[model samples]
Target: MQFANQTGGNDFTLQGLLNSADTSVPLFFAFLCIFLVTISGNVIILTVVTMDRSLQTPMYFFLSNLSFLEIWYTMTIVPKLLANLIIKSNNISFSGCMAQLFFFVTFGATECYLLLVMAYDRYLAICKPLYYSSLMDTSTCLQLVAGSWVTGVLTGLIPVLFISHLNFCASRHVNHFYCDIPPLLELSCSNIYLTEISIFILSLVVLFSCLLLTLVSYVFIVNSILQIKSNSSRNRTFSTCGAHLTVVLIYYGTMIFMYVRPHSSYSSDLKKFISVFYTVVTPGLNPIIYSLRNKEVKMSVKKIAHRVLPSGFKKTQKNVKSIF
Candidate 1:
């Protein structure tokens, strides 16, 4: 529970964001702000989608799920990073490291599958408008979301099982901000050829496979857009898909680069830099990207702002009148 610096026989030390004392305070505040904003943005999305009945469709449904995922996904890593930065200690126990690794992979793989499902939902709506309702009904959406979470849990478990059992005699210090596969593998004294191969294949399946399917869905989506006669309609459709596409490209691009390669080829500095993207930057950007680019979301947000702002202003005005 405590982010201690002392390492025992099985404990490993994480090399947090930076080593310089000068940067620690600034970095802590910076990360704290990012964490707060990310949480607030995602929470607002969840609130808007849940409260606004008009926004309760398949698209918003998946989006709410994504917001939920982003919340915990960031929670799994950012809090620890914040702790490490402020505490000025990077030590994590063997069990603690494995737990972190497990949850990180779970949320990560879940995001991959969830993104795929979101793409598929868009595909159904755009490509098969008439059948979209019947095809992606409430039950179907729930099943897809549930499956994504379950699949992510299973995907995360495998690598953790293998890596946890590995002998970490070479070094007790991990070279990155968190307990990641490549850094852990680098520390192992045992033969890690099999472990690396297993991770590579899993990445191919979870990360690359989902990405390929998402791209294919977009292919169909693009074709559907081109066939539409109204320029405005076409632009509207593009705007809808554009936000999801942007998220897909950024999430998958960073993920594939981070996971799909051989562990031996990983550069410590590069790994840390890229880790910041998926871990902090992408999650922070998701709600903003979706809300700003999405008309329905924007409208709902406006409605909420209208209701809440007026009530608060009225209360403030009453307080000012009483003071006078």
Candidate 2:
């Protein structure tokens, strides 16, 4: 589409970056700091999972994968986003936009599935203690992780492939920090009915299926907790699942609010704000949330510290000593 009064590339002129309303130097610096922490936090979790022998269990295995996913998830958006916030021009090409969407979809799907697996694991441990070891064995764990990745990659790519084929000559500006499906849909120059239906169905299946599984798992877990005769054991059991529940609540709450609602509720600003919690904040905090609140992870950290600091770093070392 040529320019109206001017020359070529008028209607299809490449777009540029859009930053926060107060995209000042201070805000830029603040976001930069947040990004750094996100990276550093996930990295620390990854390192702990890798080096700490006590953390070689299925739970830690999932956590390690999660840390890795968060790293890649943030990397997909933060660099270009930060650059766009600071620079005068923040234009991402069509190919670049599609690539970002692809990755975002993948990581999003992976998180959904991983959380389901975590919930199921929790259920097994709490409700079926005798079967936990046999159920979440190495082969089973490997299959779940592998299936999460595969499903995420496929679902993420399918919509991207279908949507990108639509002509986007009308407008190129995306109002959010990165290229997302909803924002991208707003730019389509072709019929999006089929695409919308397909994505809607896919989203429902993935989100609802996982939500149902998690809910059922928690129900069983709660029942088991109630059955415990000892208050101390009950509290200890609750503590083990508390962090996972918190993370799940924050994640599903934001996601359901964002994507699972009607289009009438759609606001790019609101979407961007909500997106921060799940995409940015959640990843950054998951490691700390788990390790800080978890006895096992805390114990693992202590073991690592004590073992690494000198020799004979007994497991009895205080968690406070491991935080450093």
Candidate 3:
């Protein structure tokens, strides 16, 4: 009956909170606070982007999609993580594991590609300012953004299929918190030759392709920055990308820490820590990133806040309807 101990069978055990260090009430509270912040922050971003007409450009359009993706991304992992932190013994059903794996892979891959797309947008804006609008038209933008989502989702399904095909004979105790590829692959009882190769190829595709794209965009952006005639012009251009660059540093730095390297060097705790940055912190920070440097987002947020502020603040509907 015990799957963790079963030999060449599908019996697998998920890891528990206590299995990791510092499984306590305070840790649970910390995670809970993070979840609340992530949800609220991303929602605010979506609202601000949706409400603002000035922000209706291809860049903000992609950002809104990203914000939506972030909300779902957090939803996929955080609730279960919160539950696991509170539950004495954390266990997930086979189907639950598969579902978690599916969304996690999909969203993680989507975020990576989305970031790359944003980089490319910045590159165009900087390297070819005159043609930026023409090149990054609405339909083209939609194609890139929508393509990233569908591609990530479809590729994500392949891994889940392989995971389902695996005959799990050995210990099913996933060392990491969530349903991750490496830990799941480690538990497979069947000879995973095809799965292994498929994952390797796909990982290389997702990891290297996006990373190279981002890097190339930055290379061109830097070249563009240097060629600007005036200091103020350069500063203005750099400022536009500053927040996004900060985010890219944090997101890609952490991602490359695990994904860009050989898998054998991986540490579970290290992986968990870095994954938390992209999966948990990135959502909360994204709203902050897009809103902080952006005047349109700020003005829109102020208007939205004015509209939504609790009953005591406003007289009401007569004059304000026109401004919105």
lDDT of 3: 0.76
**How close is each model in CA RMSD to the real structure?**
5.4, 4.2, 4.7
**Tens digits of per-residue lDDT for model 2 on 277-316?**
8777787677777655566666666666777775555544
TM-score for each of the candidates:
0.89, 0.86, 0.85
Q: How do these models rank on TM-score, best leading?
A: 1, 2, 3
Q: Give the lowest summed-lDDT range of ten residues in model 1.
A: 1-10
lDDT string, candidate 3, 1-324, tens digits:
223422223434557434645655787788788788777767767777787787888888888888888889999988877777777546676777888989998998898889898888878877888999999998899899989999889978988988787766435678766887877877776777788778778877787788878988988898879898899988877776677778877877776665544356766776777778877777777876765446676667667767787463354332333323
* TM match of model 3 to true structure: 0.85
Which residue pairs show backbone clashes in model 3?
8-169, 9-168, 9-169
Stretches of candidate 2 off by over 4 Å are 1-23, 306-324
Query: Judged by TM-score relative to the true structure, which candidate is superior, 2 or 3?
Result: 2
Considering every candidate listed, which one attains the maximal TM-score?
A: 1
Per-residue lDDT of model 1, residues 13-130, tens digit only: 9888777778888988988888998898889789989989999999889989999999999998998899888886788888899989999999999999998998899899989999
